[model samples]
Each structure stands twice: as structure tokens, then as C-alpha cells.
Target: MTDIPLEHVHVAPEDGSDGEPAPAVFVLHGRGADEEDLLPVAAELPDDRHVVSLRAPDPLQGGYTWYELDLSAGGLESSQPDAADFRRSLDLIVESVEAAVDAYELDADRIGLLGFSQGAITSLSLLLEDPDRYAWVVALHGYLPESHADLDPDGIEGKPVFVGAGAGDRVIPDSRTSAAVERLEAVEAAVTHGSFPGGHGIGPQELEAVVEFVESQAR
Candidate 1:
């Protein structure tokens, strides 16, 4: 759909809806990965909802990145994001979701977000910026952006969230994911935090947990 803001791959529900508004989960890929990068994960999602996997706006090392990394404060693994690019990408994602709501006949109240690495960072930021806009979130191998520290947590109360991390992840540490979980918990969000043994990528255990979390939320 041209009206939708970002370049994406839209997967229809496995089961036919017969014109009813279907629930939707918007998928965002990690840095240097395109919209197609996370499509395999979509196969595990509940069969009754729409899956929209979005490509980042900026081109990067043959793929795309939501924002440039700021490495002045630390090494590549602990680097921060360029504030301008990060905010722009966030706004664009918001617009994309709003447009998709009407374009895809999605159930606005059941909107969910699934993201990895940098994508996970953005997803969590979106939830914090306007917690009521999303029904649930799944963020894997990512941390909360520093710019979102002043969020109003009231709207996030009881919202279901799945935070996953790799114990051996060098790019985004488990500590970072834990910090995000703590922040969400402080807001009274219903959060499920998990850590798998691996390095910088999703494993079988992580994927299974993700599917289970989404299935529970979908129900």
C-alpha cells in the first residue's frame, strides 16, 4: 500500500477472515537487516493475524539501519544511537502503523510489536512514548533508548511485554535487556524476561518463547 509509510512485506492471516478486521503484529528487523530478514519468525506467530515486516529507512552495509551508531562513548558493542536518526525512524514507524490500521483492516486495540536488536530498541521506545497505542510488545536482543527516560508509565500498566536477550550477546548485553525489563516493571507492565545461551542472535529456545508469548497475548 502506497499510503503505508515504510517499505514492508505484508503477510495475510493463514486462516481466512471473511472480511472481518484482523489483529496485527508489526515486525521490525535488526540493524543491517531488511524487511525480509525476520519473515521466517512470522511463520511461528498465531495464524489469525496480519504480519507486517518493515524495512528501515536508511540504507546500511547492503541492508538498512534505523539510526547510525554513536561510538564516541564506547566501543561498537556498547555504542549509542544518533538522536536525530533515531527520532525520525520512530516517528516514521508510528505513521506507518497508523496508516496500516486502515489499509489492512487491522484491529487497533490488538496491535502488537515484534522487533530484534535496533528494531527492539525502537519498539520499546514506541511503547513508552504512547503506551496505549500498543497492546503488547516483544523485544529481543535490544535495549531501551536513553532518550525515552522521561516517559509517563501510567498508560503501560498491565500491558504484556516479552523481553528476550542472549546471555552471550556482545552487541546488546543481557544487562541492557534486564534494565529495560526493570523499567517496564516499574510502570506496572506485565513483562516476561528471558535469556538464551547464544551470541547476538535468536536461538531455538528464544524463538519458542517468543511464539508462546505472542500466542498468549493473541488469545
Candidate 2:
């Protein structure tokens, strides 16, 4: 267990246009990556929107991980099982996002969560834990939380969700991908799922689908 302060960075559109309320996206990177890892992906999104790429709270040897995984405790891969710690970190992230939204006068209903790998897992967890926090969620190369059984889909209220996974992803098995879809559907989320030909990564097709989903939600 190591203690490291969470870090974050933001990337705004290059154009000098400003507005009373600017739509924004909260971008989370995969495990072993920092806020900078997702900066490039933000550029691929619609430039008219504001993008904030956040770093994980805990620092790893060369990167960062949102929570610790305990394979030693049976088959459980818990995410910072310490409830208080998890909530504290999650609160920090959420607070940062809300502050940014307020500063930009962005419509809360237009904000979305976009994450890859572990970040995707976190995005799903956050959406399920607090449905009204985000209007849309985009998860890439990740599976649903193991504790999906405890979630209340009715809380989601038909929020739009986009899930993209590789057909042959070894890290996140196809079965897990299917399970994730089922869970989202059960929660009454308006889901759009896409499968690519690669493994544990995002491709041009996947990115295109994500862009389309975000644009639709933004409108």
C-alpha cells in the first residue's frame, strides 16, 4: 500500500471560442497510465467540447491504478475494498468534475464519462453507484463490475451507454463482455455495444462509434 496524491490535467479545444455553458467530457485512463495517456484521445473527440483527463489517485511503480486488486483473497479482485478510502477518492474525482462544470456553466445533463480498460470499469461503477451523476457513459475494453448483482438498474433511468470491446480480447474474455452488456441492459440503459477485431485496445472503428454516441448525447 503506497500513498500518492492524485493528479489531473485538462485539454480544451484549440479554437478560441467560449460560451456561458460548455459541454465537457471526463476522460479516465487505463491502469498503469496517467492523465496524459488519454490526452490524445480527447483530441479525436469533437473539438467543440471541453475535455478533462484525470489521473488516478494512487501511484504505481511506473503509472497509476485506481484501486488495488486482491487476487490472494480467493478470486476477488476488489477495488480499494476500504469503503471509506474508495468513497474519498471517488468524491475527489466527482468534486473536480462538478467544479469544472460549474466554472464553465456546462449543462449537467450534457456531461459524459469516457474511459478505457480499468478506467472503463470505474466509469461503469460510478454510473451505477450514482446514476444521475452523468448523462452518458462510454466504456472501451472493459467488463462490468463483479458486483453487478448488487446494482439497481432502475436507478439509471434509461441513460445512454456505449460499450466497445474486442471480440478476441484475452484480458477481458468474451463471456465477461457479454455479461457486461446484459447487466447494462438489465439496468434499462439505452446501450449501444460494438465489437472490434483487435484485443484490449481501441481501433478506428471503435473510436468512430464512440464519437457518434457522444455527439448524439451532446445534442
Candidate 3:
């Protein structure tokens, strides 16, 4: 995969409550979704933090895709080029997060990641790949990659992880979600799992839980 330059959309919190540099939340959107879709939700988060919603690099049939897929090829197989692209994009994200941490003068230990659907999967992958990089991870309607069996358990030990999924989620099966939880637990992650009554999406209760999770980590 080519090392394409990275670009992002950033939203800073409104002024006046705390003098502390705001902790940042990096958001990733679902397949076929753009950076704009997740920014408003980031704004709704507690006002004490900075939020950045990133755009995927690979261009799909008119829109952007974090990776490539072939349905006929079966079972979540990402192209080599796409996987390489994702790795490069992830590296860029880490750099950006570090820069934001320094620029905002925020608590480095408080930085977090929040992702939806495909973004959520990416967040889980990144956290499992490099444990100490993020203080907390919030994944909504997403499951861990099947390839995670190869990851070293020590990488995610003691990391705080929050996962929310709908009992009726058609996109992500309950079995997959359960397996993800099991894998995370096996790795000694501090995991909190939530299940809502709806389908394949976030609801108010899930949002509240996420806010609480992040706030708790910030403190």
C-alpha cells in the first residue's frame, strides 16, 4: 500500500469550565460514512475534551473505505494493500494523537478512542496492537477482527475497554461479540460490556455509558 498523506477533522471544546488542556477522543466512522457523521456526536460528549473525527484513506466506489473487501472471497479478508494502508493510517493517527496531546497540554494518560462499526473494529485492533497508547477505548456496534488470535495478550493487559452492542444487531452477530469479550478477558483487559435492546446502532443508554467510561478514565 502507498503511504498516502493523512488528513483529519478536529473539534475543540468550548471555553471556560476547566483550565486544563482538554483530553482528546479520536473518532472513527462506519463503512461508507464520512468524518462529518461522527463529529456531532463527539460534540455531545462532555465539554471538557477535544475530539477529532478521521477520514478513511482508501477510496471506495465514490466514498472512502478503511480497507478493501470482496464478498465472494468470503469471511472478512482484507487485501494486502488495504491492510498495509490501514497500518500506515493507524501510524498517522498515533502521531496526530501525540501532537494533540502536546499541543493541548492535556494529560497524556487520559487520551481515549471511540469508534462506531468499522471504526470500532479499528479501535479494538489498534488498542490490542499497542496497549499503552490509549487510556480507554469505547467500541459501539463492532467486533474484534478474526485475525486477533495472533496478537500477544500482553499488549492489552490492564487496558480499559468498553464495548456496546445491540442484542438484535444484524450486522455484528452476538456470537462474534461474545468471542471478542472472551478474547479481551483472556488478555486481562479491564472490560465493560453493554447490551442495548435495539439493533446495529447506538442508543441513549449506550452514549451515557460511554461518557461515564471516558470521564472515569480522565479522572
The most accurate candidate by lDDT is 1
TM-score each candidate.
0.97, 0.85, 0.83
lDDT of 3 by residue, 151-177 (tens): 775558788999888888887766567
* TM-score for candidate 1, residues paired by index: 0.97
Q: Which segments of model 2 are wrong by more than 4 Å?
A: 1-6, 14-18, 73-86, 153-155
Separate clash counts for every candidate: 0, 0, 0
Which residue pairs show backbone clashes in model 3? none
The candidate, 1 or 2, that scores higher on lDDT is: 1
lDDT (0 to 1) per candidate:
0.92, 0.75, 0.74
Give me the candidate number with maximum TM-score: 1
| Candidate with the larger lDDT of 1 and 3 | 1
Write one digit per residue (lDDT tens) for candidate 1, span 99-159.
Answer: 9999989999989999999999999999999999999999999998778855766688999
Error of 3 at 107 (Å): 3.3
Pairs that collide, model 1:
none
lDDT of 2 by residue, 1-219 (tens): 012234567566556355546667888898788888877777788776778777888888799877666454444322323444445656767877777776555667768899998788778888888888788899887776655436984558688999988987877665666678888888688889989888878888888888888878744
What is candidate 2's CA lDDT for residue 84? 48
RMSD in Å for all candidates: 1.0, 3.9, 3.8
